[model samples]
Target: MTTSSLEPSEIDLTDWDFWARPLSERREAFRALRQLPRPAFFREPEQSIMPTGPGYYALVRHADIVEASRRPQDFCSGKGAINITDMPPDLNEYFGSMINMDDPRHAKIRRIVSRAFSPRMIQRFEDQVQAVADQIIEEITAKGSGDFVADVAARLPLKIICDMMGIPESGYKTVFDNSNIILGGGDAEFLPENDEEYALKLLQAGQTLKDLVEELGRHRRENPSDDLVSALVTANIDGESLTDQELGSFFILLVVAGNETTRNAIAHGLKLFTVHPDQRELLLADFEARLPGAVEEIVRYASPVIWMRRTATRDTELNGQEFKAGDKLLLYYWSGNRDESVFTDPDKFDITRDPNPHIGFGGPGPHFCLGAHLARREIGVMFRELFRHVPGIRSTAPPDRLLSSFINGIKRLPYEL
Candidate 1:
């Protein structure tokens, strides 16, 4: 038997150039590397476009990624959950949410915030989400055509997240803009010319959100509204609640996590439907029968978040890949979603795909998405409304994707109904 091998260059997962290609092209590259021992390591180039680190392993196979997520004790996310070179400690802490933390800290935050996402609360939010989706559809219904990213895909999640937080309707755009900038990173469409201007814009965006949340938290404490913000502000476990900064960070996480990723998944749904009209027909034929599967497949196809980082807490071997304590690795969720071994016709968009275990959300771990149910509900509701309200809706052109390695985002997508 022959052991598969990979030239370091072929598997340099950190290369910005690698991510610059079409996602399909990037997936093909991962497929080409599949035989190179399930998990392969590569040292990234120094001082490139993105934050650079010493080196990291690429977990491209389905089994490898599942194992990494299953064993969070060994593959920890407390350090960072992104692939941005070497993120500064301050920045990481500022951007870090429960998703970026490991046990105890991650557990504590998760438990507290989990309160806001109870089934009863989510059920109540559903009617609001449906109304928001209708409002968004109404705003664009007569246009007959518009950039789906801005006009449709971006609206529902933005509106729902803001409404969930009890943010004033006047500030919906503000939350939407800030969430886009922070997640946009250095994308020319979102950031400024140089690193300095970009840094400043990014900081200002963070500051704006922090101040807004802080103000809202103070008001919620005084007024006590029936919303997630009020819930977070007053939430107490044995008389302990989130601090002002913690409240703000959690809000930021809610906006970014709940807004950007869900929006992207919705955007990708339109694009995917455009390409696979047959699948769309299947969905339309009997939405009740197919809605859940379609939602799962869209999340799988979009893989809205591309990958997450996990550091080896101690010397560990995954599928025979050697690792030292503190070693870094990226679990390529996008790649794993399309791994040939996992899903039949991994690249094909099948709405009825069953036994779909795609970790479009983080898989098999405590770090799994806290808002998964809400996101899925939002997607299902939005699409059901879209197909019903705008029966003739379709895209006018291919998407202009965000130029970032971390987010598999569609920056702009024109469409017509």
Candidate 2:
């Protein structure tokens, strides 16, 4: 429970201070964890929301994460995938989406919502993405320099998601702030100082998002627009349509997951390119040919959405490690992306790294990120516009990272054109 009690080499995943450490130190700690024969176990961090039940195993290695993801029946998500603590059923109305669900219900909701992200649907938004990226680039270029995160990286995805869901521009700030609070993970900048206010703030934020989307969903149900809300509220999937609560929860999942992860990826991409000029040069040399690889490398290197939890459904063994029913495991995707056995020179920022099987989106499972294709397009398009119009644009300082164990977020990044 205290830093003095832990050995220097024995990293405690549950410790909040461990997340506060510098990136390099955290990377070294995970490297040591990966070297271990089996996943490391740690007690749950104390929280006001739920009583600490059992501790969780840290699935830090690429092989272990992959196996766990592949065997969803053995390692289930219905107990709660986003938070390490057991989420109360009352909170599920706002926070539970397909990510927190297991098969049947998860599959049905995913099948219905997946239509909005299908290739045809994404192709329709391709022009919209380019237009938004261009608009953002122009706005930032006029200013010449500022916080790239707020100015450039955050705008594209937020606008695209809002536009897709028929959320008016007036509500963009609401969606943005609420999403930040929902995933803020006790960051002081986004949360109140009083611990008593924490749960209330979270519930209020979730309620705001739910109310915003449910109201829009009601309108879409009546008016029937060409947006995702209209499609989702009306679409029949095996004689089942998403209820208002389902729509609201899915909207929270979509906006928060879609907006924050892509924003961080873009922020991290600029930082990575700024640090490794050679890779930037290689990317700029043939922007069209090499960009696909660069985008993948960015997601791999950034590894946004640090980890997701899975509960053991039955007693089973994974890669030589055994788990009892109701056991908890945190799959550290960032660590998996850096596993030495999988990636050669894992620390290097190689834009041309081939066959990169990074689980930045997520491991191979039903819970893999649904917005990945959209995220890739958003990242790729934004960079293309930046390289074409502002080739010299780069981060001027290290990022102000979010203080969270879950999200690999950059709160702010000073940049120049």
* Clashing pairs counted in every model: 4, 0
| Candidate 1 weakest lDDT stretch, 10 residues | 1-10
TM-score of each: 0.94, 0.97
Shift of residue 84 alpha carbon in model 2, Å: 0.9
State the lDDT of candidate 1 residue by residue for 139-217, as single tens digits. 8887788799899888888888888889989999899888899988447789875766777888798889989989999
The alpha-carbon RMSD values of the candidates against the true structure, listed in the order shown, are: 3.2, 2.1
Best by lDDT: 2
Whole-model Cα lDDT per candidate? 0.83, 0.90
Model 1 pairs whose backbones collide: 51-85, 51-86, 52-85, 52-86
lDDT for 20 in candidate 1 is: 72
